[model samples]
Target chain A: MTGTEPTADETPTTRSIPAVAVVDAQTPGNVGTIARAMKNFGFEELLLVDPPELDPDGEAYGFAGHAREDVLPNAQEISFDELVSSYHTIGCTAVTNEGDHNHVRFPFSTPRDLAQRLPTVDADTAIVFGREGVGLTNDELARIDEICSIPASADYPVLNLGQAATITLYELREMTLSPAGTQLPDLERVRASQPLLERLYDQWDELLVEINHPEEKREKTARMIRRVFGRADPTTREVNTFLGVLRRATERPDQEE
Target chain B: MTGTEPTADETPTTRSIPAVAVVDAQTPGNVGTIARAMKNFGFEELLLVDPPELDPDGEAYGFAGHAREDVLPNAQEISFDELVSSYHTIGCTAVTNEGDHNHVRFPFSTPRDLAQRLPTVDADTAIVFGREGVGLTNDELARIDEICSIPASADYPVLNLGQAATITLYELREMTLSPAGTQLPDLERVRASQPLLERLYDQWDELLVEINHPEEKREKTARMIRRVFGRADPTTREVNTFLGVLRRATERPDQEE
Candidate 1:
């Protein structure tokens, strides 16, 4: 997932992650954006069917971002026939048939469901995306082993090619890439300790007692404070700051009668 | 969700769907793509802080697609202060702090989590995206109420602005839009009936008997067939076709010894 370079060393049969295949895309910029999205989610192999001329200085490269170096340049130009025969294909389509009578589009899996199912299949898989406007032809869809659709508003379910690919890749990231090894902070380090929380609560209770005339409502107020802290999941630093503020308030002299 | 036109009649405070705010975006095309993505996911109001000049004939309009008429043209240009003051802001960032020491970027919610949490909050909400390059500055991030990060490959976590926005909008579509009311076929209509499935299984059993298959293996074979059908979830037509094929094979004339 870390490396952007194509895994030429590993044969297609051995590859675990699905190859991203774009079929007859109209815009080179869209292709580039798809490649960029592929890289973002850690997909390496890109298969292009009937691709446009990708001039190095053209929109394809210009929009590819870092993918220009790897995914875009190393894209495999393949035929539609070759795509279906070479790998177990899942065609990504926005428009779907209404009834099961058309088996090609019916019984489609959402990208989320595919992420769970595809990993168990012991075959090289390719996720095929179609043209921006019309999407995959019925002939092409029939040939593909399965169909995957992104759930969008029925009003305008047709996501642009780049977006459809990006969302699909994002959903499949769990299967394609390992958990991010980046330097992002761990959640556990931020959670305050139980003792610290208890001390904070004790301080709050004392403050309520010192400032309040209504003894019956003090317990309810204390419970509410606890619930707020529980929901916030405040960091250790935050807890300490809160503790400090409460301590100062609790120790303060009562106002003159 | 169906309408592309802005809801001019409803006040922002009264609107349920979160407004999308872009802060200091560099490219007009990205803004256009973001607007298109907004329309795709059924989000309406768009707020821009220090946005690029979106000319009528420029890339912004060109990329806006159908959104050019509504989301793009009607985008409200406001200062960053106005953005934070008016709505409960959620900042979207790719890079995050590693430790609790820097509270600004730590403890961020993923888009999936936000979809669940944001709907419960009564306040008018805004999902604020930063520049294409640097993203939201530390100063800007500190002012935001909460942070949301998309999970990506550690190697290349930085998604382009359009893809990032598109994915975020897609995740939040559950809250923004209702379930698709389009003519897409329902799953129940296609599912083979239990009786039909049983008949198909009976034909398969008859075929195995006619072929003089080992009696011990027949039960296992039938069970395997059942499992296959269960997984395939074939259409009524598919089940009937399978039944016809099995019946023909079972009733075929036996070859002379």
Candidate 2:
């Protein structure tokens, strides 16, 4: 029964990411968890349909992480009919039909597919989730414009509500949030340059000769070393360390003799 | 302290999916949630390091869904050193370093990348997750051979332990499970043949003739109908329905006049 009126300035038309709608959620904690996931993935809007009482001191608040202040408090409440008419609705269903015989669930897009497709769509979209025990009713799913399913094991395709929402948001993060919003370190590493690699390989060859390595096997061994380093994609620091180790080994033969 | 000896016949060598290891999980419910996600994605083995007491009547059992009888109960207890020594470990972390200076957290693979890379690796691998609140310590991350990170919004990059495990498992399902294991319907729907589409287009032209549709507009309207049906990829049933409706519309104009 808890609802709030969206401010005139912050309407659905102004937002780019899809609003998340939970219909008849039995547990307040799940609502909070979904809201938290929304914040985690840069989704701003939340809509609830027949949600449980979300008291300030309840489990919902406890599980909301950082979303309690914004995403949870500003959640708008709307009727199912109003949701269908106002936005392009995509129903989230864990259990999908196996064939086109039941078109309500078949021909569904996975979250990855939706991530790619939703960008070209011009309408403001809402991704709807159903109750915890039984997902969206067939009638409700039929009314939605499209269906989205997460690919899972046939034996147990059903994921708990929170997990489903979090995973879906994670897949859609690229479109919903800018690349600058990721905390993951930049993937571009400064691998050792070709000259440095060649010097290292020469040192390795010299060490093999110093150790009385067979002349016939020297070429093969050198090729193997190149392949190994190529696959490892060693950084400059790693290559320098290897060079140092090889220098010590190559010099040791003279010292020992 | 609870541990079981893995039977001789069913060892790590025979299994294809990575063993999911939870290092010092504080909550029994989180442990159960991880186990349930493992089952959902066809991962079999569960390894625990200093886990909480998983009593039969505890929250662990309640939240395990179908994993209680198998994955949770059979979880093996091992020390962190034992984990590093026995398996090729890939540590899972939420917060990663921003540059190559911190090698422990940098140069990590996303779950999608791991899904492609792990299959080629010949060794048995274990994907390790750390504590809920503090995640894996830097020392622990350094010990693991590789790292896998789930991309998230920088504002709130951290995900609850259960959500991280669930999403990782979902991404790795392709390598872990068989194609026949999916419940999603076969995507190869029998689209209406070319002849059927031509007939439907011809019927639309006849309807335009019956209505005395403006000659200039008629060609454009016919092309639009063809384009719409082409994009729709309508099945034979749907195309027949369209033909039937168009035929009725064309016949009605003659009857009315």
Best by TM-score: 2
For model 1, the docking class works out as acceptable
DockQ of all candidate complexes = 0.40, 0.48
**Model 1: residues >4 Å from true position, as ranges?**
A1-15, A180-189, A205-220, A246-257, B1-15, B180-190, B209-217, B249-257
Clashing pairs in 1: A98-B185, A185-B98
Query: Model 2 reaches what TM-score against the true structure?
Result: 0.89
What is candidate 1's lDDT per residue for B86-156, written digit by digit as tens? 99999999988776777888778888989888776666899999999889999999999989888887778
Tens digit of lDDT per residue, candidate 1, span A164-255?
A: 99999999887777554532444523678889999999999999987883899988898989999999888888888898888888786464
State every prediction's TM-score relative to the real structure.
0.87, 0.89
Model 2 lDDT tens row, A90-172: 99998776655656776678898889878755567899999997889999999998889887888888888888898888888
- Model 2 docking tier (incorrect/acceptable/medium/high): acceptable
What tens-digit string does per-residue lDDT give for candidate 2 at B1-257? 11234566655444367899999999998999899999889898999999999999998997788889899999999999999999999999987766566688867788998898887666678999998889999989999998888888888888888888988888889877777777676563447799999999999999999989999999889998889888767767668888999999989756784
- What are the fnat scores of the candidates, in the order listed? 0.52, 0.56
Question: Which consecutive 10 residues in model 2 chain B have the weakest lDDT in total?
Answer: B1-10
